[model samples]
Target: MREIIAETNRLQLCVPTMDDLDGLSALWSDAETMRYIGSGVPWTREQVQERIERAIGFCADKGMTFWTVVEESTDTIIGQGGLVPISFNGDEIELGYRLGKDHWGKGYATEIARASAAYGFDALNLDRLVAVCYEQNLPSRAVLKKVGFRKLGQSDVYYGVHALLHECLPYDLVR
Candidate 1:
């Protein structure tokens, strides 16, 4: 059974499982949700399956991965967010979150983000966490900045879009 890693008044972050495939597919397959994420193209069902498999494997191997964020009141999966181990630029972890269109502007991202960062720093003992987004993705950039991320500079043009990297130490946000 997957453990519940974090919970807020309205959301719960838990490990992704096969049971989440449908919710995740609906969330990931929407073009609007896919915008600014790697490629702007929406993910196919097959790709969503593969992603679920990969997320499960990543959790087993790394003890960390993007988790399913569910709305507690409705028992509906509104999104996914968490800390992911990465090797980009160096050995480090990155924070990421994506929510369904219906859930946008609800502050769920920031709520789950705070819990994820606390888990990464206080529980996992990570030194820092990083986040990257397309330069034009103002909403995401704003969320990262609001969470205390400082712009490190531009990153490689990925998926035909210029990206920016931001980083924050656990203390930067937690304290």
Candidate 2:
């Protein structure tokens, strides 16, 4: 097991491992869960394996990577999320998350996102964090807004689509 990264009342965030592939694949393969993500394509097992390899490498190199978000009480993995380094206009820390359909509307997204943002600011010492999502992803936009990310009036071509850009500072985080 990897070190625990964050915890909410009902969830725990920890470094992702190969063992997470089954749960992670199920989450990523769901069309509704991946609708706004890359290519809007449900990931295959091979793709998930590649992602796991990349995540492991990312953890090794950066000491931080996407975490497997799990329900503590049920010991079930409901999602994966984290702060990742990305090029939003040079180097920047980007907060990202994805949850299974069954986990939607449970406030788990907000809970994990808030925790992930805290780790970026408090643990990683990042002064600013950013996020990008499909313009139509209202739920994700709402989560970003709730976390104090402001719409930057900028758009970036990502995942073969234009995504709205958002930014937040350490002070902007909702404590």
Candidate 3:
């Protein structure tokens, strides 16, 4: 069963199930969409399955994970977004979002980031949330800024890549 954890005007963030493998695979396998993610390479179907399994584990153990993002109008899984322990097991939590090529530039990223931040702060009682994006990922950085994250400059502490780090507190959210 799919659990709806959060919602926006046009999207629903749900706990991912095995059924999401195909949708997630399609999203993660797109070379352009996979750019700036992890190794900056598209993930194979097996890798996508591993991600879904990890997400399920994270949700069960930590009460949060990068949720399966669904377009409410079509009920189609377009991407993933939500809070997760940095690197999947770090002490700090981070808000993250990703969308397929077809969904870019539609303000959906902002919606996901804002809703995820709200969920982290309000629902999860998180004192602060951090986010990281590739230096060249201008649109993602913009989304983080629009959501009220303060840039902490570059850091290689997470994801083994030098990412532009940003942090936000409950009161700093734009919601």
Structural similarity to truth (TM-score) of each candidate: 0.93, 0.94, 0.97
Tens-place lDDT per residue, model 2, 1-175, is 6567788888899888889999888888888788888889899988988988988888788867778899998999898888878744567878899999998999988998899999888988889988898889999999999989999865654445678988999999985
Q: Largest TM-score belongs to which candidate?
A: 3
User: What tens digits encode model 1's per-residue C-alpha lDDT throughout 1-175?
Assistant: 5468888889999999989989888888899889878868898888988987988898898888999898989989888899887754567788999999999998888887888888888888898898889888898888887888899999773335578988999678843
- lDDT (C-alpha) at residue 55 in model 1: 85
Please list the Cα RMSD from the true structure of every candidate, rounded to 1 decimal place: 1.8, 1.4, 1.3
lDDT of 3 by residue, 11-104 (tens): 9999999999999998898999989999899999999999899999999999999999999999899999999997554678989999999999
Order by lDDT, highest first = 3, 2, 1
What would the TM-score be for candidate 3 when compared with the true structure?
Answer: 0.97
**Candidate with the larger lDDT of 2 and 3:** 3
Clashing pairs in 3: none
Model 2 segments more than 4 A misplaced = 87-89
> Candidate 2 local accuracy as lDDT?
0.86
Model 1: number of backbone collisions: 0
Which 10 residues in a row give candidate 2 its minimum summed lDDT?
153-162
